[model samples]
Target: MREFLVEITTTVPEGTGQEEVDRRRSAEAARAAELAATGNLARLWRPVGELRSIGVWRATDEEELHEKVLGTLPLRPWMTLTVTPLESHPNDPGRLDASR
Candidate 1:
């Protein structure tokens, strides 16, 4: 299983309230759980920052990962998500070995 990162990037609507934010976040969490059941998601998280990015680390092939993200999330109607392969850094090639 290869690790890929799905980074959600989008603008929050002007005047959006905290309640709405919470609701959407709850929705995302549910969807992430569903993805986990599909053997696609290894882990997921939302960054605490101004950008409000939702990042999911998935263990699967590229196409399966992409399909899972596209099929599972609320990304299409409201947000834009960028998916990238999470590769080991040349200086940190042993990073993944720690998991085994």
Candidate 2:
């Protein structure tokens, strides 16, 4: 598996109902939990003062990351995602700790 950093920005359409937004948000949360249970989702964080999230995710490849994992999001239509593939660094603390 490969790790990726994904930044997601959400934009609700103009005039969309509050109930619909709530429903989608709930569904999105449920989906995120499912992904986490399966180890596809590693970590998530929200940037201060932004309607965006940054997350670490695992997948076989970029295509799978997009199509299979992220594509399953209920709020995908309203989200813009930027994905960055991660490579292990020799001096990464996590790697060093694992080696020990």
Candidate 3:
């Protein structure tokens, strides 16, 4: 299956507290674990450098990748979901393809 990067963006409603955000994060983690159980999950990580955001790599087709990301988020009125294909790379690039 093709691998994709699923992006989960949350926009909390007005008057929301830190507790609610934590709760949503917890629920999202649980859902991610469920996805990981199956072959759909490739890897989960966060961005580095100046930007920071949780990233989940999932194996899915074009039509279903974004749909799968929806399951990773909580029920919120202002949440935005996005999915994009991830470029495949070797674990040890230095050891292979020395002809680069």
**Residues 3-63, model 2: lDDT tens digits:** 9999999999999999999999999999999999999999999999988999999999999
Winner by TM-score? 2
What digit string (tens of lDDT, one per residue) describes model 1 on residues 10-63?
A: 566788898887787788778868877876676656676656555556655778
**Stretches of candidate 1 above 4 Å error?**
11-25, 37-39, 54-56, 90-100
After TM-score superposition, the amount by which residue 83's alpha carbon in candidate 2 deviates from its true location, in angstroms, is 0.4
Residue 62 alpha-carbon offset, candidate 1, angstroms? 2.3
Model 1 residue 46 CA deviation in Å: 3.8
User: Least lDDT summed over 10 consecutive residues: which range in candidate 1?
Assistant: 68-77
Alpha-carbon runs more than 4 Å astray in model 3: 7-9, 49-51, 54-56, 75-82, 86-100
The 10 consecutive residues of candidate 2 with the worst lDDT sum are 91-100
Better of 1 and 3 by lDDT: 1
TM-score of predicted structure 3: 0.58
Candidate 2 stretches with Cα past 4 Å from truth are: 96-100
How does residue 4 of candidate 3 score in lDDT?
A: 70
Higher-ranked by lDDT: 2 or 3:
2
TM-score of each: 0.56, 0.93, 0.58
Which scores higher on TM-score, 1 or 3? 3
RMSD of each: 4.4, 1.9, 4.6
lDDT of 3 by residue, 1-100 (tens): 7777666555677898989878877887777677777766657655565222455555557666555544444643455656677654655464446453
**Which candidate's lDDT is highest?**
2
